[model samples]
Target: MPVLVAVVLVVAGCAAAATRLRVAAPVLLVVVGALAGLVPGVPLVEVEPDWVLLGVLPPLLYSAAVAMPATSFRRELRTISGLSVTLVVVSSLLLGLFFSAALGLDLGWAVALGAIVSPTDAVATAIARRAGVPARVLTLLEGESLLNDATALVLLRSAVAGAGAAVSVGAVALDFVLAVAFAVVIGVVVGRTMLAVRARVADPTVTTLLSFTVPFLAALPAEAVDASGLVAAVVAGLVTGHRAPRVLTPRDRVSDALSWRTVELALEGAVFLVMGLQLEALVVDVRAQHGSLHLVLGVAAVGLALTVAVRAAYVVLLLRSARRRVRHSAERSAWLDEVEQRVERRVQHLPADGDTRAVRRVERFRARVRQARHDLDYVLDERLGPREGVVIVWAGMRGAISLAAAQTLPASTPDRPVLVLVAFTLAGGSLLLQGLTLPALARRLARPATADDRASRTRARMHALLDEVAAREGQDAPRVQVLRAQRTALLDALEEGALDPDAVGHALDVLDAEESGLELRGEGLRTS
Candidate 1:
């Protein structure tokens, strides 16, 4: 019953959000989940860890990866690599150190805590991407998010191992490497197989379901082999996303994208609502334990502060390194800025034929990468990338997992619980408080909205002109005299404020018809 209610709430939340925020559906789902917690007797259901890491994470990551052309991802590997691999590891270490010291917890234990929560989920990044963030910026955020989950989860397992003597440091390190490598292999294998299956099957719905199951299948194998289930699921999605294009027909391609998006949205909402509802258990446990209120606040503050500081520092370093490399590469290129521009222009003008399509595609992709690289060039580049990256990093906050981790903590003794009430409180609060606000916080740090006045006015004028021009001309205006008469009629319509912005849309539709008519005839043929 609660699950059904949650689904109803999610649907209503999406509708309301469309009218109010104009943000992505996932963001609204999260808000719905958090807010719904306030209703009395609304049971806070504990979402299974397997379901979260295996079921929810995979499709979301896959959908995000697929929405992006595989070409863009390969081209922007540098940006993605920095965020996904380097920053994740560094942030995990820094956060671990901070929490351990500030909260009077064991260093190893704190590091374990940090590792588990280190990776940000793709849910936040995907929603942010749809909200009009830049391509490279979105890539960086999403890539980091997609890959880091595995790394963090591995660290989490390792952290759990320190509690026992069964696993040695060297063995743990080897296992981590194996887990990562295995996740990649499993993901690719599953993805390739599924893509082949999708090609054989024409039914989009079946293909979609098959795509959905790949993650679950990959996750089981990875977990059976003591690997990261999150990593396995993500890799499976990524591989399948990147491959589905070649295997499926154009219709399948369309269906794949649509189905991926729909599945991702549904799963994301389910996860966020589950995250919020689960908060009750943590709250109850902490309160019952009579945990130190000050301690909880302190720990939460420390985790929040550390996450912020390390992320800021990481962004600064990444931008600095990218800038330095850019300058060095520029010097090595012997100032080929003009040459690069010429190449780009040539690529743009190249005839769109089947044979040249491949070459043109490559050139165009490289051009986009070059442009992104140049923009991240010397112009106070430090400030923009660093700020954006840091904001995203903070937005990576996860409270539900931390709360789960707290619950997983064993009793230290009869009088003392190893899962410190304060820690659990901090975890739950961090998930709810920080997770809920991160998107808004990230948005505020972005540059102010620039005036689109000139573009807007030109567009408005064109739309007004086309609409009036079309209505007057219709299908009988092929004669120059008829065209002139149509123009006059269009003028009269415009004089009546028929050129209003909303009406411009209708105008554009007419213009499209006019253009289509022209295409069907020789030069100078006009459409009514």
Candidate 2:
């Protein structure tokens, strides 16, 4: 208990200091913990692999997914998949080969090591967010981090299971497909069921409490079936976040956000702190096992270099594809416009009040056409260029996940101590080398001030739309009613892709604040 208290205090202290010093908290906490670990007489802090993978990981991922904007997630799905799945597989295979040659390890065990380090941790998103990178770039990074863990872990399991034998590629592929399919089903069922139950509850506290169980509820069952529990948790979160606006009350939404933010901070801080504290023990184990710590460090350096090189090359390719997509979407948008015009002309020529079903079908077709065009426009507006690509490449740093996954390697695995040390060194080195330098790189590549002009225009237009809605409601209407009407209009615009989600989110917050203030005043009057 004392040790736990001390750890929390240290985490809190480091976080506070990082905030005051304008530094990334993860980077600061890791440094402090590392230095603390080396102090004479300090207790060796060892973390169980299960504690991290089962306890810390789900909540961290769930919180992130709940906060992620689903529209952006869907929009960048292709890029995210390329990075999270395709890149992970390619990097793991290449690193496996490299490690086999460099470390004189068996192929399967080397590949297992590769898989342990493959996924970019969600901590990278927190770092990138602090750097004020473009929203599209942040989305890509967040999406990649959210989904890549499943890919890496699945690969690791396969490699471990077939360490000395020929692992069938077809079997691995089939297993992956089934795991994902099952996880998705589990996630959807859990998400919708919880949302339905929460909708009937009136108390904000109760709803928030229910929200806490969501990740575990989604993850446990998925894992029971040998599926990707992390993916299940992520899916549940995305569903909740996307649907919360419609199903949850304003108070409930605010409560969940505030509480989850606290949980995220505490869990994330502890993970990094623990990461740093474990370094000395890992080194000790390497030494006790007669492993060459110096040689392992060199191997970690090579692994880090390979990871970055692969990411940079993949990101460049993604950007090229994005450019081509923009051009293709533009052409498709024009073609749709022409088709809509012709369809409208034909509809106008039809006899009035004739074939009502046909008229309804035509309207439905037109609605689909309009939606398609809006989606294409969204794609065009959020195009990724070379500058964004550079940020994405540099921001792909490893963190807690790599270290935790490394610890999960079987005890009997060959050179276990040496492999674990290499993983720790790679994670720490990546954090220090990439995390510390990312902010500066992000600033240098940041979009010019002129870029905000479009955002300003969008906000102004959104506010104007709200004002018009309020005017229609009249000054005689209840204040709450007026605010609710404005909110409805804002959400409608968001759904139509006519207003930016960021702008709409801000507008909704304003509405919530006003309503909350009104409720507070009413309660005060009643008490008085």
Count of clashes, each model = 4, 0
* Candidate lDDT values, in order: 0.59, 0.86
Highest lDDT against the true fold, candidate: 2
TM-score of each: 0.69, 0.94
Using TM-score, give the best candidate's number.
2
Q: Which pairs, if any, clash in model 1? A: 399-431, 467-507, 473-528, 474-528
Q: What's the true lDDT of residue 217 in model 2?
A: 97
lDDT (tens digit, per residue) of candidate 2 on 110-197 = 9999999989977777777778787788888899999999899999999998796788999888888899899999988899899999
Residue runs of model 2 more than 4 Å from their true location after superposition: 343-367, 523-528
- State the TM-score for model 1: 0.69
